[model samples]
Structures are given as C-alpha cells and as structure tokens.
Target: MNMQIENNFSYHAPKPGQPEIYTAIREKAKELAYLIDEKAPNSREKSLAMTKLEEAVMWANAAVARN
Candidate 1:
C-alpha cells in the first residue's frame, strides 16, 4: 500500500500543540459564523455558506492532523 494513502486513512492522535491548533480553527470558525448570522440574511445560500464553513473547518483540522 502507498504510505501516503495509509497515513491518510489511519487515525491520528493529537500530538503536542495540536489541540491548540484545533481550538484556534474552531474559534475562528465561530467568529465567521457569528458574522454570517449578523450580516447575511437567512436563506438557502446562507445555509450553504454555513455548511461549507463547517466542511472547511473539518478539512483544516484534517490537514493539521495528517501532516
């Protein structure tokens, strides 16, 4: 099997300092969510924006963990 594929598929435990990185990502996402709530009108577009934001956060965390 390819090493990169194996690593990407495997679970990665939080190493030192990773928790803080995750927290920062979450905090920033929360801030963006709040801004969206305050500024963007509630609609399907707004909902999709929120959903994409969530996906972005997940990918960011995965990047941190996988790298």
Candidate 2:
C-alpha cells in the first residue's frame, strides 16, 4: 500500500467574543486615523502625527489582547 502526504494550513481561530474586540479595534483605528493631523504644517510634523496614530492602533490592539 502507498501513502500520500498532505500539507496542512494553520487557522486563526479567534477566542470567544473576539468579534467584538475586532469591531472595537476597527473603530478605534478609524478614530485615530481621523484624529491624526492630515496637514501638520510640515512633512516632519505629518510624519510624527502618523507615527502617533500607528502607536495608538498598536496600543489599542494590545489592550484588547489583555482583556
């Protein structure tokens, strides 16, 4: 008898209530994006604002993971 080998893919099965967390994350990201300075008077300031927005998103995601 011959046996065939198969490859398996990993699935990201979210924990219970993760959908709510996902939704909240999305909303917060939107809020952060909008709150960021679109025109910060200069390229440097705009980059800084964008960085802050990115950090906000990361923080929100981390907070949700902790909850």
Give Cα-based local distance difference scores for all models.
0.98, 0.63
The true-versus-predicted C-alpha distance at residue 7 of model 2, in Å, is 30
**Candidate maximizing lDDT:** 1
Write down the lDDT that model 2 would get. 0.63
The TM-score between candidate 2 and the true structure equals: 0.50
TM-scores, in order shown? 0.94, 0.50
| Tens digit of per-residue lDDT, candidate 2, span 1-67 | 2222111223345678876887887787777666665435557877787787678776675555544
- Candidate 2 displacement at residue 53 in angstroms: 1.3
Question: What's the distance in Å from true for residue 52, model 1?
Answer: 0.5
Residues 1-67, candidate 1: write the lDDT tens digits: 6999999999999999999999999999999999999999999999999999999999999999999
What CA RMSD would you report for each candidate? 0.7, 8.6
